[model samples]
Target: LKPLGFEGGPELVCQSLAEGPFGIESQADVDSVAMPLRKLVEGDNSSAAFVIACYSDPGLQVCREGTDRPVFGIAECGVLTALARAETFGVIAIAQRSIPRHMRYLRQMGLTERLAGERPLNMSVAET
Candidate 1:
């Protein structure tokens, strides 16, 4: 990230929620992380930018509302980047249950027309 001109480099933060499901395979799983994630980001005062890390980006909208700092979601970034380089692109996901959320996000971005396909690896979040 430093080479990309992110001064001081980027910090990577991991979320290990004890109360939620281990893998984000469903909307419920995604919702389970939202508040916790929002709280985590809200408490942090020093980050110049925050990347949600998860492809599902559970709390992205809520988190963004809580901070003035730029917030990025890995899945959104990947898809947008791909769109910039290709007319259409496919997504490789960790679980089938996540596809709907991805689709919804794409639709919200008004980028579904650029999606070619979405394929799942049938793996848990921990495995992949």
Candidate 2:
């Protein structure tokens, strides 16, 4: 986003976030590849709104509780954006478990109708 006049950077919460075939294990663990982003708020250059990029929405609720910043997640994000663009869209999930998870997320977003379909790849996430 920086190149497009919006500043953006990547943060890794922990090594294990990507060690498994899935990028993350549990929700709390999403705060990964071993970085402490929470510190940014206390020092300087603090941001009021934050966005996380996991379908799991990891550490999101906790982050919200811990800070005053607004947070966003990618999986929920794409569904929201797509709702504005199209009434429905296909989800190409990496695993069978992801189908229900994604479905649940869409439901949480109140985007059930907007979710056109779920097509699980039926394999480990890395394979697809």
Candidate 3:
């Protein structure tokens, strides 16, 4: 993000939630971080947009509800962008347990038809 922000590009700020599940493999994992994510988003007064960097996009709606600024979930953003330019798309997940959650979101967004497949690396954040 830093490298891409150079040469007068929009400044990007990245932050991690200090108190939440370190790795998200299930709904519980995503849920555990909701409050912390909301608090972080509400506290930050610097940026005009907020991005949930995690692939699982924990607390995306909560963050959006708390602010008028743009809120982006990387997974949703990537999927939407890919679908705009391609017929079908796939995702490489960090674990098999994450596939169901990912699929759920795709289904919720009515994008399951556009998804080609999802493959998991079966690795944790530390391993990656």
Candidate with top TM-score is: 3
TM-score of each: 0.80, 0.59, 0.90
Model 2 lDDT per residue over 1-128, tens place: 43435346543232133332345543334445223434332332445566666566655655556576576667767766877787687777765655666666677767777566776667544655
Q: Highest lDDT, which number?
A: 3
CA deviation > 4 Å runs, candidate 2 = 1-22, 25-48, 121-128
Tens digits of per-residue lDDT for model 3, 14-121: 787778777888899899998889888898888888889998889999999988899999998999899899999989888888888999999999999988878777
Candidate 3 residue runs with Cα over 4 Å from true position: 122-128
Clash list (residue pairs), candidate 1: none
Worst 10 residues of 2 by lDDT: 12-21
Q: Which of candidates 2 and 3 is the stronger one according to TM-score? A: 3
Worst 10 residues of 3 by lDDT: 119-128
Error of 3 at 127 (Å): 21
lDDT of 3: 0.87
- Can you tell me which runs of candidate 1 are displaced by over 4 Å? 1-15, 122-128
lDDT of each: 0.82, 0.57, 0.87
